[model samples]
Target: MKSLGVIVEYNPFHNGHKFHLEQSKITTGADVVIAVMSGQFLQRGEPALVSKWTRTKMALLNGIDIVVELPYAFATQKAEIFASGSISILSSLHCDTVCFGSEQGNIHDFERTLAIMDSKKEEYDLRVQSYSQEGYSFPKASSMAFTEITKNDRVLDLTQPNNILGYHYVKSIGEQNSPMKAFTIERTSAGYHDPDFNTTTIASATSIRRALFNHGGQIENVQQYVPEGTYQSLAHYQRQAGGFHRWEDYFPFLKYRILCSTPSELAEIYEVEEGLEHRLQQTMKESHSFDEFMTRLKTKRYTWTRLQRMCTHLLTNTKKEMMQRITSTKKSEYIRLLGMSKKGQSYLKQVKKDTDIPLLSKVTAMESNMLNMDIRATCTYAMKFPEPARSEWMGLEYSKPPIRYNEETNTFI
Candidate 1:
């Protein structure tokens, strides 16, 4: 079977995501589409609006044939590391192609930028360091440095989130020297950062999320922007109770972690670097709410997203030593199956025969150091949900069955 791999968070699967999936299949002429998705926390360094299981079910119901969980180690990282981990997984799965959404969908431009960055690594690093010393966020500095190097405006596109991710995807493909071909679908809706709900079917994940988070979790607000199935599923999930999470829900726990830990201790957490621990310690002392802390923590040199991710690692007790070990291993990690359609399961069987890395459909079948943090993160996330839901899944990762598409029943079970 011809397979195309797409990396997604699908925070809540919406119509725009549906369009991307459909267009990816059409563009690649693939019989199956596999997805590597963030587990519980997203790359943006925040908890997902819904649980990973809910998101995985939505993915399978819509168009994705199979969904694999991107480990928490990779999920909550910067673009390059995130892309590297994701692309590595797809490569290991032997996907022939990968597709991603981008604001500017010029393949030549992506290649040129990637080539320049790859060839002039030291120069680029030095330039980035110079601007970073001047207190600009690494993303901002990196974009500025690319502009200076290329003397072109298309490099400006890298500042947009999707295009940046697309760039990293290309870079990772190059780094791997993998056979997977990469393609990009132009994003036509509200931009990634756009938070206001537009009337069109094409709305940003940010817009959908903001509407849900701020407007009392009313599915009606985003119904037009999501597919009928997604809209209905969300309504069903909401009615059933225990869905939708806000950052504040976990702030008390985060606050306690920050208060109890020393700068040295916070420094031991992965991603807390270069005296950022000092600033974190000082900020936690005065901050009132999660929002207040985020605002105070945000600076030109350290984006709020980066700081938030660091704090997430702290709250989860993800250690620098553990991350260092994972990083140094220099191999694609296991493919943890989140869910699969019937056809997906069949395709996975073929993949299993050709692969040596663990294809983890059964969490209880094995234990690895890599899984410990993810399990901890999930348990922490579960604690924030309401009663029955929380109690039922407090440690269900080890017991819960992988979601399988019931072909006879015409539904996921």
Candidate 2:
């Protein structure tokens, strides 16, 4: 069966995501949709609002036929690593194409951009350096340099969060020169960072998250935009105590990590560039909140998201060594299963014989093994919720079931 690949967070499944999935299937005529998704942590360095199991179930309930965890290291990393990790996993699955949402939506333009970057990398790199030297933030400098090279007005907005990642996706795929075809669907919804929910066709995940947290919007109103199972899941989670709205609940842990960290130790953390370490140290002493600290550190030379991701890496004890290693490495020989259907199962078996990677559908207690260690670390943190809730969350790994596919209808159950 032909499979179309997607890299997702689903942070919570909503209408826009469902549309993306449906369009990918229709456009590619793909028999199966496989997703490499974020786990406990997301790409931007924030904890997922819901557990991966819950999100996996939601993905299955929606249109995805298979879901594989993106792995915590890659899920919470910068664009390059994020794209590389997702791309590697999809390629390993022998997927025929990768479909993603983008602002430009024109695959030709993306291809053109990639060609320009590859051919004129040195000049572009020099221009980016010049802009950074002139006090422009990384994102701004890169965007400016890219626009100067491409002479496209829309390229200026290329630095927008989704567009940036989409660019990296194309770049990474080009570098790998894999057989997977690439396609994009134009994004139809609120802006990536917008926090409003006033839309009909689709709403941004940011807005949906805000509405869910604030309890100000009605889920039924956006019912058509989201998968029914996802809507039901959110409703249930909302009614549960200690809702997932506030990410700052973990602030104390971050503060503790910052407080206990030495300058040398902090220097070794990913994104801890020369003077940035000192600034973070100083901010730790003066700032009272994550938002405030980020505000103080934000400069024209570094985007807010970059700084936030850096801080998150440091707080999570993600060593610079690990980041470097993953970047230099070309492949992941293991597929950490999040969930999958029967058709997915059949596809896996077909590919497994020829795949260069191991397909891991179950976790084992092997702390010494590097691959299993990663899974263990995620499980360890996931099991840390308050009291009885912690036990319930931890037990999901064993109790939460994998999806079974129905071959007759060519759908995942």
- Give the number of the best model, judged by TM-score: 1
Best by lDDT: 1
What's the true lDDT of residue 174 in model 2?
A: 72
> Using alpha carbons, what is the TM-score of model 1?
0.95
Each model's Cα RMSD: 1.8, 3.1
The residue-by-residue lDDT of candidate 1 on 190-229, one tens digit each, is: 7788878665678888889889877788888898898777
**Residue 193, model 2: Cα distance from true site in angstroms:** 2.0
In candidate 2, what are the lDDT values of residues 6-125, reduced to their tens digit?
999997888788888899899999998899998777877676777777788788878787888877667767788789888988988899999999887878877876776787789899
Worst 10 residues of 1 by lDDT: 150-159
Q: In model 2, which regions exceed 4 Å deviation?
A: 152-157, 216-225, 239-241, 365-384, 391-413
Overall local distance difference test of candidate 2: 0.74
Lowest-scoring 10 consecutive residues by lDDT in candidate 2?
A: 364-373
For residue 354, give model 2's deviation from the true position in Å.
Answer: 1.6
